[model samples]
Target: MAVELDPQLMDILACPSDDHAPLRAGTPTDPDADVLTCTSCGRGFPVVDGIPVLLLDEAIPPADSASTSRAGD
Candidate 1:
């Protein structure tokens, strides 16, 4: 059986670098299809090996390299 994720832990988990918006966990359709979407930025953060990859590049990188990347900025 899969371990039940701690609600409080999930509750406290915002976009890795973004604290302004909260994350709402979703049910993965496929075992490998894991993702957490940011409501504010409309970016999908992926979860791999039971870990959520919350970096912007992890979801979608800046249009250009010059953009000093920050989460949901």
Candidate 2:
């Protein structure tokens, strides 16, 4: 099911990363993923039971971030 977060809350929600970018509902990869994706870093923070888990440890980093880090090695 699609998560329905308040528009006002969404507007205030920011990614808990160094970028601290604005977050939007769901992700670019999956619109119904029940998570909020960062506009800058593209990390996806899962929403559990209507509560947003914004911790960096809980965030699913963008696929490219993984590959890019590996490529640098």
Candidate 3:
């Protein structure tokens, strides 16, 4: 089930990536509607059991990003 986060919490939440971009909740039509998407990096952080998993390793990067590695990687 898709988790609904509080507006206040959402406001404080940001992507864990180096960009530290703002996050937007996934739309209902999205396959990963339970995720929180980074506005800048296009990575999706999963929300599990009402808790957001903001770990970079757990984040799903954008499809196009798979072909490219980060600067250090």
Candidate 4:
């Protein structure tokens, strides 16, 4: 199921990185896939079961195809 995040919450959400840029919502191809991307760093944070996993440890680094491809592993 897709989790619809509140616009107000989205507005307040910012990247936790040094850049602190605003997050962009992902356009999921699947119902269960949702993410928030940092505009400055290009890091991706997964959203599971309607909650965004915003932890820095859980973030996907920018331009890392290997990490993204192996995400399911």
Candidate 5:
């Protein structure tokens, strides 16, 4: 599913790993990417279905294999 961001929500959202100030909407890895990143923590949060999966277990480090959130699968 594709995640949509609310203009109001974007200003308040911050990285879970670290506040890192406001998160940037797009990264070099992706332009249409729904993930937002914390420059300080280096953790990326992927927003899906208009909800941000902020849980450490739910979030996966950017991978090359596929866009699977399973870190230990």
Candidate 6:
């Protein structure tokens, strides 16, 4: 089953980072997965068992330049 979040809660969700910018819902890799992305810092937070893991330690940083950049694209 797809992990669903309440629209009302999503509206108030913000990044726990220093910037504390609003978070955007991300496309989950798995049906049971849910993710929230910080627009300002480019950090991603995972949601487990339908609960968003907003902890800073659990946040994933944006992809490195080496991994995101291609030789020619």
Best by TM-score: 2
Better structure of 4 and 5 per TM-score: 4
Q: What C-alpha lDDT does candidate 2 achieve relative to the native structure?
A: 0.88
Stretches of candidate 4 off by over 4 Å are: 1-3, 27-33, 64-73
Candidate 2: list runs displaced more than 4 Å: 68-73
TM-scores for every predicted model: 0.57, 0.85, 0.78, 0.71, 0.60, 0.72
| lDDT of the candidates, in the order given | 0.57, 0.88, 0.83, 0.77, 0.64, 0.75
Residue-level error in angstroms, candidate 1, position 9: 1.3
Looking at model 6, report the run of 10 residues with the lowest lDDT sum: 25-34
Taking the tens digit of each residue's C-alpha lDDT, what string does model 1 give over 13-67? 7866555577655423322336665556545676676777777776743224225
Index of the highest-lDDT prediction:
2
Residue-wise C-alpha lDDT for candidate 3, range 1-73, written one tens digit per residue = 5559999999999998788998988833485489988889888889998899999999987755765666448
When 1 and 2 are scored with lDDT, the better candidate is: 2
The C-alpha stretches of model 6 lying farther than 4 A from their native spots are 1-3, 27-33, 65-73
For candidate 2, write residues 11-64 as lDDT tens digits.
Answer: 999998887899988788778889999999999999999999999999998978
The TM-score between candidate 2 and the true structure equals: 0.85
Please give, for residues 1-73, the per-residue lDDT of candidate 4 as tens digits: 4447999999989999887999878633333447887878877788887789989999976656557778878
Off by over 4 Å in 1: 1-4, 17-19, 27-33, 60-73
Better of 5 and 6 by lDDT: 6
How far in Å is the alpha carbon of 34 misplaced in model 3?
A: 0.5
Which residue pairs in candidate 3 collide? none
The residue pairs that clash in candidate 1, if any, are none
Task: Per model, state how many residue pairs clash.
Answer: 0, 0, 0, 0, 0, 0
Candidate 5, residue 69: lDDT: 47
